[model samples]
Target: MCRLMVYLGDPIVVADLVTRPSHSVMKQSFAARERLTGGPGYIPLSINADGCGIGWYAREVERKDGDVTPGIYTSISPAWNDVNLERITPKIVSPLIFAHVRAAMVGTPVVQMKCHPFSIGRYMWMHNGEIGGFSALRLPLLNALRPEVAQKCPCFESDTAVAFAVFLNQLDDPMVQLAPTALAPLMAATIATIRHVAVQNGRGDETSMLNFVVSDGRTVVAARYTNATDEPASLHYATGSAFRRKKEASADFRLEYHDKRSRLGLVASEPLTDEVADWAQVPPNHMVVLMHSEGSFVDTLVLPIDCESPEVQDHVTRCFRALDQSIADNAPQALQQAPGGIPRALKRPSFATGEDVPVATAPETIFEETGQSVLSVAADGTRVFSGSPAGTIHVFDLQTGKLLHTLDDHSHAVFSLAVADGRLFSSSMRVVNEWDLTSPDGAARARPRLLSTRHHSDGDVLALAAAKGVVIGGPRDVSIHVEKACADGVTQNSEATVGEQKGELVRARALLTDALTGGHVSTVYAVVVRGRWLFSAAGDAAVKIWDLDAGKHKASLYGHAGAVMALADVQKQPSSGPDADAQKERSNGSDAATSPSDGQEERSDAPDGGFWLLSGGRDNSVRVWDTDTRECVRVLKGHADDVLALCGGFGGRFYSASADGTIRAWSTATWSCTQIFHHEDTVPLAIWPTERGVGSGAADGKVRSWLVDRK
Candidate 1:
């Protein structure tokens, strides 16, 4: 067994993958965490000291027409002890890289030629597992390869080399660039062919771990498979917007997803970093394909593979024979049928031509409170809840735009509203009211009966967030109040207050307060609860992160030039495939709010499903911050005035309402403004994202819904 890694994304120095990480491929050479033991042909040695190799495509600036083949370097020395590798890797940078550290199979020689990654024409390949009883099947495997592929094969005495030959034999022209869709199936077919040969030679019962990775400069496909039941060699992958070494001298690395689209993709036999959440195990019998999309973002796809299937077995046999005959007959069209049942490559709509930009039509008045300015808006799956300055909460059907109920709860203006746990929470001066959406009484259900009202001793309640029986209220003052629902139908108040008291930061299990000497220094404008962490946007131009469990200040993110007025959490979405739906459902069902700007839903706090915080600032820009890294990855500046409200996680898009009288829809994939809904002479105060459009509360005393065509 060996350690191998593949990187397909932004250009990075070779050391980033091979040498620098805490558990990099080089480190895995000696201290692998998940390599199989006691398997057929498996050596008991813990160290992969046989050899080391790396292959990388030339940087764009150095690439010429026919000279784009990758550069390869191999040495018959332990990767850690390779002085030449250490000296040269830091100086080499490439966008696509394949690296491996070998612990050669029982009979394999420790020669430079034996070290992966093997290259033929424009492709590079690396293997992490051994083929059981390969010595008996070598001649048969070579004989099965097409004559042209056999002529070009390097004849290296390695199972990986034989597998590479089989892979090339399936390609009509090994030198021609193939799409990831084409490459993925051919890779699957290669595994099937190897299995067929193993079964033919009576080695079917023996374990054959075929963890392989192949790349054609622009596209990459990696497989984790084993003929035996035990698990395939520990293959894992991670995707994010940026992959960075935490500190200059530290081996720790971080993969941050600033938004939905992934800018980096990594596949490895062992995790490169100690951050457990950063890596996801690739299923035993599956392949992961990384390819560049037309939108210029990397797309990752995980596909299941069944080597035992008769259809797959026959497909591999016929694919190669058909390819060889096609080459002889000079019939390129026959190559179309060569790749069978492989999922077609995803062709995402290109954002370059503005085709994906949403079209915002005229706003349809959902409800008009005659003379009261709409102050807050929140939404669930079917209803739009709008709060007014008159303390009246109006519920409207999302589909019909008809008023469902009007409840008078507070004596003061309603500034914020939130929906969570089948309840609606509305906040006003010195009090927060909770209404039961699932109330048993039919009459009370339509007009959700006010369950409880907690009086705040501080200033006006400016923002509200509720989840898991706890309600957090951000006040006009620099303090945050926590209210817990008691089993006895009462409310328990625990104020986490932060203020200028004695210029010292206060800490408590429930009370939270930032000192004027250090923290917020102004009113808390918005509060969002995600898991055990509470995020508060304040008038001090900063967003502070609080650990709810500890009730202590964790970190403060600062980038806004002026006061941060509105805050929303845009839950990160899976880039592609079946997992996207599962991940989306998980995000929607958990702490992450479906409509973040509504200040109502509990946004997903699944630590692994990272989130981006969108803060609308008085600086007239909306900044996107990666909560994990606490870094502002993007600052969207299109609003001519201060951005007042923000909402995201609606069909790969986010919307921002500005005091400039416009609500702008942004594509989360591109981070570009796609559509703008103008409110004429009024400032849109709050926005909530819906399935088909966005609902807004504006200064013009109207609750409106705008149809956003995102298709």
Candidate 2:
């Protein structure tokens, strides 16, 4: 076992968190005061000074200034005398950080590659405690890794690294990449998979300390756990709104806990100071979640892992489903229909359009490895795309229900995506790449030949809307926060040029003022354009409608009590021709741009004959607003947690994805939730309306589609 520490909340200096405390992570390395004993006086190593490691999300500025990935330093030398660490620790600061000191189990080696904090892409993982009979467990666990991950994972003698490999296998599973909460079970199953293999290989008798931690550089998940009979190593956490040590430099600097009820959490192997009362010990079989609250403060959740629970079955089923060929054969078929068109085959008995049979929900087909932040469907219904937390984009073919391409183009997470004129627009902090979807397989690769790149120096392109010929970008950036904090000397150094660059980040936020109509007071999270009308949702808790052509604010529609996180626009339409020629045209062009008002009747919901805007919010409620009157017609409430995304005009229904990990489908007539798909396994962050059904992306850097099939 070893000493492990995880910090998730406001930014803090590595020197203070890992070095300055009275019993700091540095102290733990050479003088671990509480080493555990097996039995009969056989105490494990007292000094965890075999090696040390620190992993942190480098300043976005560091990356903005050309530093590519997060900083991860692992050394075979003890941290107490590591010259490089001493020089770097004081200068480095980050919101998310992990520092670990190692005391290798009996069979493991003391080497740099065997240090804590194993990382791949944006994911960083670490472990304390040993795997029972690790040598026996190692090969199988390593073999279980995803081929891509296996190839990339460095060869190391540490059992912790192998456990991380197993965890990586579960993590990179397309199904496991749904959401953050889904990670807990996937992690548990990874441990279970290891133990099952260990037992099968006849190595189950040894001790196993499986306390583990992992993060995607934003959301942090840590577990204090052990095998069936073993007691866990010490693990405690402290959380509050304010996490600070005194501003004054002192050798006895200890993290002070204030505002105990507020949102912020930190996990460590032991208490950082003598504030024993403020620290709470983690339960043996539970996982700790730490994520940013509304802003910088953290929201924490502790969940139990019951190995025999249905989670295991679901995880297993998903794994089998992926490996087996049966899924492609038994895949749910989409009864393709124009939006608002209810097919006659499954007509409700009470309000029958043609059939006398009772209506039932269609069979659910879950697509795996969906990106978390954004999901967008091509207007023609031929392609569906999702953006991942790992800076990847997954593209799927709607007809065959098969993955077409995985575009790993962005150096940061792809936050905004839009489809226009046979091209996909993907934007991150600064770079925007437009990919020509009509190109071949090689065209989906990073720096694809047909791809065009553009830079938005204004700010992060938080939302994107591409329609007809107008491309509107709604910007948001966290750089301003960094700049503001820098002014207060939060990250100040003696260097003057560094301070000026931080100021540039704030000025960058003001650069895109030309596009702002009446100036959104907060980060713009959504953007949609219909004809000359543009709809956007910002942190101001209001949906602003602007006239794109006039470049002026029309009205600010207020309804959502919390920040409006998602928005979808559906134009009222009358029944269209069922002829083959009409269907062909519908598949070739964006159905969203077609104006039925030219000849067809407007849907009853839009009495004034205009488009309807459906918006979802952090309040866990969705409000349907009529653009003509700028009034909310209905408030849909079915999700138990914050609604992160909304999708509408999919086969006469609307869909919303929530933080509680579910998708609720709404009826067009009543604006009521007709079906709730409990994908509670993953936090669904993005949802998109598709001609066949719906597509969703979760926090775990995966994307999937749900195809509805008639009974």
Q: Count the backbone clashes (under 3 Å) in each candidate.
A: 15, 8
How big is the positional error of residue 528 in model 2, measured in Å on the Cα after superposition? 43
lDDT of 1 by residue, 276-303 (tens): 5456667668787776542233555555
Could you tell me how far off, in angstroms, the CA of residue 566 lies in candidate 1 after the best superposition?
22
Runs of candidate 2 with Cα error greater than 4 angstroms are 38-45, 65-68, 106-108, 171-178, 253-263, 307-711
Instruction: Give residue 226's lDDT in candidate 2 (0 to 100).
Output: 73
Residue pairs in collision within model 2 = 174-369, 369-702, 369-703, 370-702, 370-703, 371-702, 371-703, 372-698
List the RMSD of every prediction in angstroms.
19.7, 22.9
Per-residue lDDT of model 2, residues 1-711, tens digit only: 688899875556788778887778888877776655433323255678778999987544444554424579999998888888888888876767899988764554677888878787667889887777776667777776777767766564667767766776655442222343456566778778877888888887776778889887656788887775756887877664344454456555433221111234678887676545445566677676665433233445445554444422332223222212111221101111111222111122121123222323332444544424343333335666766534667767655546766788676556677877655677654555656555445443222223445554334455777665335666443111111112221222222232246342111122122112233434477877776667777644556665554444545555454456788976654432123333221111321121121112323322243556888876568877756555565667656666777777556677887766667777665455666554533455677777666766654444556664422
